[model samples]
Target: MPRKERERGAHQREPKGRKQRKAPSEGKERLPEDKPEANQLKTEQEKEVKLKSTVVDIDSVREKEESLALLEAAEQEDGLKNKNLGVFEWLLMVFALALVLLFFPFSIWFCVKVVREHERAVIFRLGHRLQGKPKGPGLLFYLPFLDVCHKVDIRLRMLKVPLHTVVTKDLARPELSVVCYYQIENVALCSAALSSLTSVLQSVVQAAVRDVLAQHSFSHILLHRRRIGEKIKAGVDSVACRWGIRMERADIDELFLPVELQQTLATEAEAKRQQQIRVSSCNGFQ
Candidate 1:
C-alpha cells in the first residue's frame, strides 16, 4: 500500500511540471497591451519608406531639370551663332554695294552681258545653279566675282561626220560620210550635260549610220537612200533626245564603192543598154 501511494505521488508531480511548462507558453502569446507598440513600429517603418521614395523622386526631378537647362543653353548658343552669321552676310552685301557704286560704269561693263536672240545664258551663283529658267535675249546683269555664266547657242546646228567605213550585209565594204542637222531644245541640259557636244554628236551619228547600214546590202542602200536616211535619223534622235538635242535630219552626204564593185556595176549597166538597143532595132525592122 505504501508503494502504491508513492506511485500516486510521482504521477501528481509530473503533471505539476507539465503545467509549469505550459504556463510560460501562455505568457508568450500575443498581448493586447503590447499591440500599440507593434503598431507604432510598423508606422515608423512605413514613414521611413515614404521618405526614401520622396528623396529618390526629388533627385530624379533635379537631374531632369539640369539636363533641360543644358539643352536650353546649347540652343541659345546656336541661335546666337546663326545671328552672327546673318550679320556678317549683311555686312558683306553692304560692302559689295558700296564698291559697285564707287565704280559705276566699270561695274556695268564687267557685270552686264548681252545675250543674242539665238543664245541663252545659264547662271551659277556661289557654285550653285540659279533655280529658274535660263536668261536670254537681252541685257543680263550678275555679280561680277560671285557669279559665273555659260552662254549656249540655241539655234540650229550642222554636224558633218568624217568618212567612216562600214561593211554591208552582202559583204561589200563602203565609205560613208553623214550630215546631221540638229537644234538644242533645252539649253540647260545641252550646256551642262555633255563635256564635248561636237564629239558626242559625231560619235552618235557614226554609230547610227554603221548600225543601220549594216542591215542592208550595198545595192539596197543606194536604191532606198531616203528610207535608210530616215532610219539613221530615228536612231540618232532616240539618243539625242536624252541630251536635249532634237535631230532635224540625218542624210548620207557621200558614199564610195570599191573599185571591183564599181567595175561590175558598170558592165551590168552596159549589158542592159545593149539588150534594149537590140530589141528596139528588131521592132523597127518588123
Candidate 2:
C-alpha cells in the first residue's frame, strides 16, 4: 500500500512538471506569431504615412491651381469690360452726331476745324487715340461732343534752359545758360508722347550741358565753346529722337564764373601781360 501511494504521487508530480515545460514551449511558438503581427502593423503604419504625405502635396497643388484659375477669370472679365461699349454711350454718341447734323452749315463753325499748314490735329474719340496718321492742313469735320481735337504745331521751336551750376574737371564751378532749337519730326508722337515739350526739352538740355561741361576744364570749355555745344546737341538729339523731336542746335548762351575765380584769372592775365612786355623790351634792346 505504501509503494502504490508513492507511485501515484510521483505520477501527479511528473504531469505537473511536464505541464510547466509545455507552457514555456507554447509561449515560444506564440512569439513568432506575435512578431509577424507587429511587422504587419509597422508596414501598415508606414503606408498610412506615405498616403498622408501624398494627400498633402495634392491638396497644395490643387489650391495653387484654383487661385490661378480665379485670377485668369478676373482678368478676362476686366478685358471684356474694357473692350465692350455700353448702350448709353452709343446713344449719346448717336445723339451728338444727329444734333450736329441738324444744325447743318451753321454747325460747321464747331464741327469743321481748319488745321494750318504747320499745325496737326490729333483726334481722340471716346478717350482713345484715333487710328491712322494725324489730321492736318485741311477741314476736319466731327461731332463736337463725341470727338476732341488737340492742335500740335509742327514748326520749329526754341527752349531756353534755366541757369545751371556745374563743377568742371578743373574743380571750377560755373553757372551756364543754354538755348536749344528743336523741330517736331512726328506731330502725332509729339502730341501723344510728351505733356510739356518745353519743360522736357529744358531739362534734357540742362542735363546734357552739365554732363558735357563736367568732363572738360573751365579753360577748355571757354576756348572750345563750339565743340562743346556740338557735343551737347548730339546728346540732346539722341534722346529727342525717341520723342519725335529733332534737335537743331544747342548753344551755350552765357557762362558766369565765381567772383573769386574771376579775380584770380584777372591777376594771372595781368602777370602774363607784364611778362610779355618785359620780354618785348629785352628783345628791342638786343
Q: Which stretches of candidate 1 lie over 4 Å from their true place?
A: 1-98, 266-286
Look at candidate 1 and tell me the lDDT of residue 91: 71
lDDT of 2 by residue, 2-79 (tens): 999999999999999999999999999999999999999999999999998777575677567655644554453333
Q: For candidate 2, give the lDDT of residue 185.
A: 74
lDDT for each residue of candidate 1 in 102-189, tens digit (9 for 90 to 100): 9997887888899999999988654555656789889998877767899999888999998879889998989989998999886766
Report every candidate's CA lDDT. Answer: 0.82, 0.82
Model 2 — which ten-residue stretch has the worst lDDT? 74-83
**Candidate 1 collision pairs:** none
Using all chains and alpha carbons, the TM-scores for the candidates as numbered come to 0.61, 0.63
> Highest TM-score among the candidates is held by which one?
2
